[model samples]
Target: MNIRTAAVRILNSYHHQYFNYENKIAATSDGLKLSGKDRDFLYILVKGVILHRSYLDFVIEIAAQRSVKKFENTVLNLLRVGVFQYLILETPPHAFTNETVDAARQLKKPRAIGLINAVLRHLLLKDELKTRLAELPDNESLAIQFSHPQWMIDRWIEHFGIANTQIIADFNNSYQKIYFRHNPVKISWDDLSQILKDSGYTISVAIDSPILFFSTDTPGELIRSELFNKGFMSVQDISQSLAVRLLNPQPGEVIIDACAAPGGKTGMIAQLGGRESIVNAYDISPAKVQLLKNEAFRLGLDFVNYGVADARSGTFPMADKVLLDVPCSGTGVMARRADLRWNRTPQDLETLLVMQREILTNMVNAVKPGGVVIYSTCSIEPEENWQNIEWFLEANPDFTIESADNFVEAKWCDKNGAVQVLPHLHNETGGFAVRLQRR
Candidate 1:
């Protein structure tokens, strides 16, 4: 399939809010039988437009002499894809113009052909796509230049300061290297390293982390190999692995993984908790529970058990250690989930804050008096991390913050015994994990 058709299908799915953006893209690609290169280009076009929709529209309004809101959804998306290719990809001027026009005709958008051509002609004459967008105000510049929401940029500026916020914004706008953790229970790092190397994979060890990273090109080869099927390696961000490290599950200890889905942390718990340790994992989704069961079987985690259960609704069995990786705003993982910046809204943060409080309270209740509770989220929002911890501590005087520096690197832990991994500073997914002990 051509990039234009695939991008349009993805945009239609995204605009309708019918299904997940990335999942829809994968399904569309598979349905169209796209080649590897065409699939990559389709992803680039779709994500590039979504990631930079605001900025692209700002440029489009300048060239079209009208607000993009006035155009129909199909025309607007076509313009976005066309402008993204012409300006950002820097495709040959004439070739891109002709290709986009042909795409519109092929899609049976004859009524929009003249308007598309006129806009492209005007954009070519204006030549503003290459200009440095420096003249605008700080808020406007950050929004249009980086294609992020103004409210989010302002919040980051307040939290990280002006210069560092820009650095983080730029990082979120780019692709991050894929990180993987070698399953120590299945295979040692040295052994896995040699195996991957022999399989024509380029591998590098992460600094200050036991994790490994490799080129993204060979994922197809790795996914189909015995290493993945047998769970010799697990794909996760280094910051996420820190949660399992901080939990420090000991031999024969009982661990409860609340809200566990896809079972990365649950598997890590089984590995770290020793062969005799017991791990009970729970998720709200029945489908996710099945996935957890599959992961456990693949990794040979005999001690780990999983079921579908909601953490907020009922009491859970008391355990020596509990991990509550609660869902949050996902501000920390924008690099990998490119469309997240557009999907999130302030209202969603409000809903998540309520859910996080409930889940943390329940998990804390489930842990034994002296046992540890690890509260974590893949979010940089203070309301979801430190502030939530503060609220929990204030409400429950029996629990106190445990120094996380004992397990994670001192640099990743704050003075309050919380780990806040910033993407710009750490060059990984943004994350926050704090350990609490019930007195």
Candidate 2:
């Protein structure tokens, strides 16, 4: 199979249909029976194109001396893949141009073959592209250079200032390292580390946490490893682990994971809280609940109870702690979810805010008096983080803010005691979490 051609088809499908990019890529790779290296290269091409799409379009427009809107979707995506290879992957100019032209032909876009060749060849003259890009205004330049939406850039600059916003954008554009959290219930961290090393993979343990490990190795290899299949470790971000840590589940405590789907946090709570803890995990989707159940079984955490129910209005038994990892615009995890940056819009934020608010208001009812509710999101937006907490507190006078400093370092916590993990500063995915104790 032509990897570039496959990548073009995937990109075209992604542009039209809103599906998880990782799952889409995996399904396509499996169907094609792609070799290891071929699969890796295909991933790099498709994800790299999506990651730097705006910047590629910028160069394409400059090189072709025309707006990309005028081109057909197939031709535009063909050019995007070509420009991404030449500029970002640093593929040989001759091979990049010729192979991309061939991909267009294979996809039955013979008419676009000449145009793809011309635009890709023009990108070889890097100076001209850079000169033209430099002529744009600062905001437009930042948006194009970082491949983020202009509105998002503007919002970040207003909230975090230009320097920090640029740092966030740069972090999002770069590839992220794979982080794994060892399941102590199944294996010791020391044993897992030695096993991974003996298997010829270089692994590094996080300084602050022994259970956390990270590697630059290919994620597919790690995921398919025997240790992973046995549930010795889970692929989770260090930032994500913070919310569960802040929850600090105790043995015999009844914990409710209100929005538990993939069950990373649910598994962590089970591991940390021990078999004595009763974990009732719930999500709106039955498919997600099934996935959560599968993950729990893999980790040997049968103590966790799984159910399909929405956090917005689900009935639940009162618990010592409730974790509402609410959905949001997902602005924080743009790097890990490559297509998210393009899929999210300002209007989506307003819709998510209402749902987040509803979930927070309803879930707190399940928390017993003096118990804690940890509201969290994989988002950096203030509206989705501290602002929601502020709104909840005003409406529910019985709840009070509890500092996250007790669970994490002071640096990760804001003045109001919320944990705000920034990708640029923390070197992990950005996220937010706050502990609210019902008085």
Best model number under TM-score: 2
Clashing pairs in 2: none
lDDT of 2 by residue, 12-62 (tens): 887543677777788889999998788878888888999899998889898
Q: Per-residue lDDT tens digits of candidate 1, residues 362-418?
A: 777788979999999999988999999999999999998889998888989878888
State which candidate has the highest lDDT.
2
lDDT of each: 0.82, 0.87
Worst ten-residue run, lDDT, model 1?
Answer: 207-216
Query: Which residue runs does candidate 1 get wrong by more than 4 Å?
Result: 16-18, 125-135, 188-191, 207-217, 220-227
TM-score of 1: 0.91
Candidate 2 regions with alpha-carbon error over 4 angstroms = 207-210
> How far is 65's C-alpha from truth in model 1 (Å)?
1.5
